[model samples]
Target: MAAIAGCSGSDGGSGGSDGSSDGGDDSSSDGSSDGGGGSSYDGQELNVLTWGGYEGVSQMVEDMGASTNLKLISSDKEGFNTLQGGGASQFDVLVLDNQWAQRNAKADTIVPLRREEYPAAQEGTIIEKFNWPYQTFGFDGEQWAIAPRWGWEGMGYNDDEVELADLESEGYAAIWDGDYKAMAADAPTSVIPLVMQQIFDLDENPMAIEVSDSRLETLEETLVEMFNSVEAVHQGAAALRQAMLEGNAEIVLGVGNFELSQLAAEGFDWAKVIAPPEAGGWFWTEGLCLVNNPDLNRDLANEFINACLSPEGQRSICWDGESKGAPANTAAFDAFSEEEQKTIMMYKDKGFEAADEILSGLDQYLISPQQEQWTEIWERAKARSDL
Candidate 1:
């Protein structure tokens, strides 16, 4: 999402990777049997905390308005710690990035989801991805939360600024190839690894992380090199997009919101984004993890997820005819025109098929350990570079 764009892939069904569920109405083991109050509005207050820009809940409300009358109350959190502190269940649903699930689930900050209890989280293509090799929200085969949207993790460039061939062939060379400055998402402890991930992917033992004491030296070395060229670090996607729009920055190095291409219809340049061919990671597998709240509106939260997964609900969240955040509901693809679908489709193509040893190896090398050691070294590396 930051400068070097590599998004986690999600879009109802783009056909990438083997682990994700088909995401449909089929129930998963003794699922939620609780009957939600049918659409009477019942004046119930449903609270949800999520990353900024998620449309899953609001769109669902509109979709089920005729059937589930209760209105959902939602809020936004920019980071994970906010969700870890006690009081997550106060809201009916908590939508968070998937990476943080294991930690929070263990702390009991978020509760395991009873897919059988809620209709939306349990049904449709949207929530299906959670049933994987890493289901963190629930226990013994139950789900903890749902994934309403996912991002595409691959390389991107401003088409207007560079040719696609050079990008795919040169790999990071494309961004570093020119005199142009390379800007990436910062919070080195958090974002630097994404850039380094691409670098390690190009080396021996592509699946190995450079985090071990033996590997730590390698992580430091790789980051030091990357820091030499990185420019300003964006705070968030909106800020990143605005940077590109204003000419304050020229290139990014992470997941792409292909829907942004639709901005061309409104005059935003179309030539900036490019998916490098060397290999990349999907954006973090974002799922509906939670921030504990005491006033959880269990019933409406369930309805909210179900509605957003609906075809009609998915269409409601589309921006400029294409959904900015990829919808997990396979049915949502219909929301965009054929062309918009084509642009976004590349993320799934690249990720599901590309060499992922770099990303998987990184989990052990830098990101896997509970401690944030590499994050610190990365920050010092950043300080040295002044980026």
Candidate 2:
């Protein structure tokens, strides 16, 4: 699962903790010299920097007989900082949150898309809801990226260990019940507001968290309490899953669908993912962007992106594997069998409408001023957790 994706920085700009660029090594793209007068880049390699889970795309591209070598790699906040530092040449494609997307677009760190070039990005191919201007990424009619996956961040609990009824009834408060061993994904966007919601009955949008002496104290106090309740605080889903499997944690804070799906694939289906209606969660969409790398074969990158957005690519990602997420393409959701959709938690019996309602409750609340504040307090909270 792609959790709270962000980097410590000033408003709308990416910067590392030490204020320097860090990411993938810059390399020249070597296009395959296929025998078709160099028209086909079938055996070419496309360097990709993402938050993981693109194996589906790679597999699908291969199935189509393209034989493209997908140099799949992972990244985190550092990747964002790297992009902002003008390191876009290291990779041909990047998967980023819309907030980060805006920053890259504003900074001109990525390429503007001409939809006519990418067939998969056209109207009938992409999901209707996400095909509008700037729906994924754009600025003043200039498109830059397309959404491949979208989901919410919340709690994932062991059903056999923690009562589902308790979670539903008490909402996010169930994490602190003192009955189950808990662990949290360490991210300010999820942890801070979640603690505020569980402890203080906060009903406002989490992105608009109020910063004040009293609130800060309450947050600090609550974070300490949460830290005391849990075994460890982690920054990655795989780590959280390992903690749960090792019996160190039975309930996980900030677990999302992507993590749950991956866990399910590994025979850990005992956990149930939930986004409480009361406390709510963050709704986010991750867009796929083409890096404006001059040495890279631009045509190959476009072709790879097109193949990734195809129904097969989307299907491979949303289902048919471990890396599960809600598909950005509506048709991809339909491609799943009745049981598969239910198993993946993509559609509850009411079809996509029910899914939409659940997603509607979550707000895309990452903005300026508050982001810097959140970062500052988060560092302090982590330190306090040690105490």
Candidate 3:
């Protein structure tokens, strides 16, 4: 299924006609803004690569007086592969997962962002948890990416078949219960960490990247067991949702509240997401990064980033009618109506403090240095014929 498009309306927050707070002159008919004698990137094309349905970002960039060429990608792996294959120079801005952003920063495939240049990128403008030096997207004392959207991955269960209290008490162990048929996404990044937590019986910091050789062996065994126990392994949110709706599985793993919300909207009110009590679920963020292209127009690119961080921009990027994820910019909550805020998984009636408190309890998804090794282990587990 195609990702849903963002809800329309709103000029993308306070600023000049170009969607920037720099007090620039009105954009000319040709889509070029003169920022108080600053250089106008006339006729320049801002090439952006992001997930499908993030057109709100494109609109923000276009409003900034630049022609935009937006390329939609299906997965973080696809985006990372594109950059690794020397395609970084083709786009000025790229939106990727936090871990992928970390990889690109380490590979020098993306440039560091100057926080001071953009008001929206500065300290206190966005959620404090996503600020600079946050391990997920920051490293080497540089801000490598700006996370504009975030959500947590947990088990989605049919309320009719499973008790919330039972899942919470059992935590990761709930997936191993032989009586309950389970299904999961094919995403190793989303599944492995939780598996590790289960194997280690860890109550906190389930995202530690370094895995010792002995731990790897044990993890392999556990993964094989978990895989064999599941009803089937599916790819994409659509397939997972289908399995649950068809009663092929009573529980789905590696899905977030966003998916559950989508299911509820479709009249599957019994669908619900829960972070296992013992090992809090994993949280993921979508970050916007500057591609390391020498030919890139830095000024316009920065402007685009700034615009996306605005209140209206956050609403456009984070909410689509059915699925509501938290915006990195807290001020964006103001753009949403009370009903809309209540629908947001993180925002609910309590507001930003509530969101922050919930996030604080969840584990951040981090880049595992041995990711390839983990994938190999996962594949080997999946290949085992004996249950």
Candidate 4:
């Protein structure tokens, strides 16, 4: 649980973290922000941050580093308050939330990845297709955060409780429908992303927004209506998996992952898909990011990223061990046995809308403390039985 966090280029004696440089580190060997940050390298002492589900990244990165000059230190923070209070910069590479990557990259909280540093960056994953023109800190012309891992955001129907037909008829509003209503009001932060997406989709959908002003009000009303109709909220994926497996939920929001996919293979019946049939699916690429330290640790950090996407590393750790998900590297995908590839496909989407475009104005992944406060909105929704 603790090991999942990387670096090395130059050797500086100054910018050492006295713990106050929470957001900034000295720049490294390349001298530019690309390979540098704080004033010191501090040996192979790597610090990492990933959400709860990705707890396995530690052993995976450590194994990858076995053949390289890097040793990464990793940690997972479940709630945003930990990041909000500061001290995030105490680590080197951060597997930040995909949405914040765009907002923070420009602010210097996380630095840009040079095209030259990653040979596999382009052909490997969704990152290459997302960027074209480089700006101050982002890849390509638009804003971006980090190279993504695999796409998610599938609709989940709890096999025991909800009927698929009813689930479809109500759309996002279904979470608050019927006996399952108890779970809807208090659902975890994960479900809010789905609600916001539904809101984003409705406001943009031709059917939902034919007229401009009045209809917009109607859409907002519907969103607020659906948002307030919940009774319970549960967060961890393990808990969700347990709920479904034990028959506590008939239908719920589904995100593609090993747990869900494996559960289905073991005879659990469930269905999932991308949201807004009119628009493409949504996915998240979980990859490495520089903490912006320019010290002896620069070169090592660069090496760490390289090893992570390496085909050999991908084959050894991806999905087979604690680390689960499709490999971002093309070679890693190819290296997957037919069975492994098929297992990952249960979650992968072929023609997802370009993340840069979908996230252009309203990227939902950007869950700042204020946005996460949707708990209040949800509580209100639960209070009303119907709009």
RMSD of each: 9.1, 5.8, 8.8, 10.6
Choose 2 or 4, whichever is better by TM-score: 2
Candidate whose TM-score is highest? 3
Off by over 4 Å in 4: 1-90, 122-148, 158-170, 173-189, 196-232, 254-259, 265-276, 279-281, 315-323, 345-364, 368-375, 384-387
Q: Which stretches of candidate 3 lie above 4 Å from their native place?
A: 1-42, 84-86, 203-207, 321-324, 338-353, 385-387
Give the TM-scores of the predictions, in the order they appear. 0.67, 0.76, 0.79, 0.60
lDDT winner between candidates 1 and 3: 3
Q: Give the alpha carbon lDDT tens digit for every residue of 183-294 in model 3.
A: 8766676677777766685644645657679988988888888888888876556677778888988888777665455566455667777777566776767788899988
Error of 4 at 121 (Å): 2.1
Order of the predicted models by TM-score, top scorer first:
3, 2, 1, 4
lDDT per residue for candidate 4 within 55-150, as digits (tens), equals 233344444342111222221222122334454445466554444455455445556666666766554453443332223125435433334344
Off by over 4 Å in 2: 1-47, 55-73, 81-91, 115-129, 134-136, 197-204, 208-210, 246-248, 294-299, 319-322, 346-354, 365-368, 382-387
**Candidate 4 deviation (Cα RMSD):** 10.6
Among all windows of 10 consecutive residues in model 1, the one with the lowest summed lDDT is: 11-20
| Residue-level lDDT tens digits of model 1 in 215-308 | 5666666666666666666544444555666665566664355424334434554523444545444343445643456665555666666655
**Tens digits of lDDT, candidate 2, 120-174:** 5665556555674654366757877787766666778876677777776777666
